[model samples]
Structures are given as structure tokens and as C-alpha cells.
Target: MSNFLSGISITLSAIALAVSGWTAYQLSQLNLLIDQQQNTITEQQNTNTQQQDKITQLTQKIEQNKALISSDTTQQLNSVSTTSKAQNNVIQPGQFVRQGFDNKIKIELQSVKRIQNPDSEEKNVVVVQMRIRRIVPKGKVDAISLNQSRGRNPETSEVYRTIQNKSTSFTYINDLPQDSWGNAYFWLKVPEGINVIDIVIPETAIFEAVPISS
Candidate 1:
């Protein structure tokens, strides 16, 4: 009876030891699984942060582009407004139209006269008289002529060339002092009955609605 009781006690002790070892292994596995889960969650959080940063940067770029477009549109509108205002200031005849840079020269329309052609009574010569004065230079000045001048019939839009030989009287000048003005004539041959004309000069704006004196 005593031997049997000792065998039973030893078997009970072995079973308890095996059970404890198995419990420790299960705890270790649980710890490993928890660590792996935490690592996966951390990686996911990092990826989410990077994606959010990219979205923020794109938003900033879009706003910057909008601002640039608005500024360009406003500048274009202001340019158009300034051009319209300048066009409203119409330059008239007899008023001095300045040429070149500041104080270079100013030309004035003195008079417009019509004379019957000596060769043909039906034809007429239109004379456009101009005066030029120097403002910047003090002494000697260059000779000025109306060789390239033209006359335009506003009603018909017909253009007439200046007569070279007949205009040599007052068109060409050699002794025009600075600050003093001289006469430059432009003669155009046209058919009879046409009165008012437009004077067109090279490098100058057209003189419109100039009445011809008979």
C-alpha cells in the first residue's frame, strides 16, 4: 500500500511540470503576435502622414497659380484702358506736332492754298505750307523739306504726290537758325472742283480736314 501511494504522487508532479511549460510557451507566442501587430500599425501611420503632406503641397501650388492669373488679367485690363484714353486725344491741324525726342523739333501747319496750273486751266496745284522750329539746339540746324509729303482727298480716299520741281521755292532751306522757323511747302496737282484735303507726311501723323484756300 505504501509503494503504490508514492508512485501516484510522482506521476502527479510530472504532469504539473509539463502543464507549466506549455503555459509559458503560449505566453511567449502571444507576446510575439502583439509586437508584430504594433509594428504593422506604426508603418500604416507613417504612410498616412506622407500622403497627407503631399496633398497639402499640391493645394499650395494651386493657390499660387490662381494668384498669378488674377494679377495678369488686371494688368491687361489697365493697359487697354490707357490705350483708349490716348486715342481720344485727337491732334488737329495748325497745332504743332512734336517730332523726335523731347525738344528735338516742332512743326506747324501755316496755311493751305490752291493755285491754277499754268499749263492747264482745268488742273490745280494744292500748296501746303508748314513751319518748323528747333527747341533743343541753339545754333545751326539741318535743312528741312517736304519732298516726301502727300495730299489725300478724304472723300475719295485718293492720294496725290507732291510736285518736286514746282515746290523748290520754299520747301528747301539752308539758313534756318535754331529757335527760328522757316517755310516748307508741299505742292500737289489735282483735278478741278476738289477743295478740302488731308496732309500726310513721313514719320508724322496725317493732318486731317485741312481746308484749301482758293
Candidate 2:
């Protein structure tokens, strides 16, 4: 009876050991599965972040494109209108013309001349002289603001800066009393072959296709 009991004990011990080994193997598999799931989640998150960045960049580009289109359209319309008005009223050198505004402000183109640049005689410059007169005694306008005017080359669609030279005589229009006049000058450095240039005064007037006399 003792020997029989000893054999049974040994068998039972072997079975328990096998069961423990199987449990350990199952636990190791479960841990590996959990690690794989975590790695997959991390990769998915990285992909989503990259997609969001691309979306933001694309949105910004779209907005920029819209603004550029709107600006271009407005410029085109203004250019067309200016060209038409200038064709009808062409002012030549040594000629003076008056343009009335609301019967209150009287703007005159005193002269437009092509002169030799003092700094470089070979390079020609176009000079525009203008006079702003207040007709109505009750109204006041800023005449020195003419300095912000710009010149445009209709042929090349390029905008030029108005240089203030020694010959430029501009009076502060805001300082002038009512029923007074002020003078301003604009100088443009243009290419030798450019025959015509346009002047655009914001909210004032557009002088289009003025011939550059040599």
C-alpha cells in the first residue's frame, strides 16, 4: 500500500508541473499580443498627425490664391477704365488742363516733360507737375497726399515709384487756407524705349497713356 501511494503522488506532481508550464506559455503570448496592439496604435496616430499637417498647408495655399485672384481682377478693371478716359483726354507737353472735382477741388496738370537726369544724363526721366486749387471757400482737402501717387507702365504692366527730386515743389495742401492752391511734382525713372506711361492717383484720377516726348 505504501509503494502504490508513492507512485500516485509522483504522477500527480508531474501533471501539476505540466499545467503550470502551459499557463506560463499562454501568459507570454498574451503579453506579446498587447505589445503588438500598442505599436499599431502608435503608427496610426503618427499617420493621422501627418495628414492633419498637410490639410492645414493646403488650406493656407487656397486662401492665398483667392486673395491674389481678387486683387488681380480689381486691377484689371481699373486699368481698363483708366485707359479709356485717358484716350479721350490726351494732354501733351507744354499744355495745361483742368479737372474739376465736385465743383470744390480743381486739379490742373501744369506740365509733363521728359528731362535728362541730373545724376545720369544718359538716363531720361519723366516729370509731371500738378496744381491743386480749392475752389469752394468752405471745403478743405489734403493736397500733399499726392506724394502717395504711383506711375504705371501700361506696356509692361509694371508700376514705378514717384521720386521726389530737387525740382519737385510740393506744398502741404492741408496747411493751406481755404480758396488757396498748392503745387506738387512727380518724377519717374523709366526705360529708354518706354514711350507711354500712366499715372494713377488713388481716389483722385488716372492719367493713362501719356506720351514720353524725347
TM per candidate: 0.46, 0.46
> Cα lDDT for residue 20, model 2?
93
Which candidate gets the maximum lDDT versus the true structure? Answer: 1
> What would the per-residue lDDT of candidate 1 be over residues 10-114, giving only the tens digit for each residue?
999888988999999999999999999999999999999999999999999999999999999999998998776444332346453545323455677777777
lDDT score, candidate 1, position 55: 91
Candidate 1 residue pairs in backbone clash:
none
Q: After superposition, how far is residue 62 of candidate 1 from its true place, in Å?
A: 93
- Summarize candidate 2's per-residue lDDT along 39-91 as a digit string, tens digits: 99999999999999999999999999999999999999999998875654456
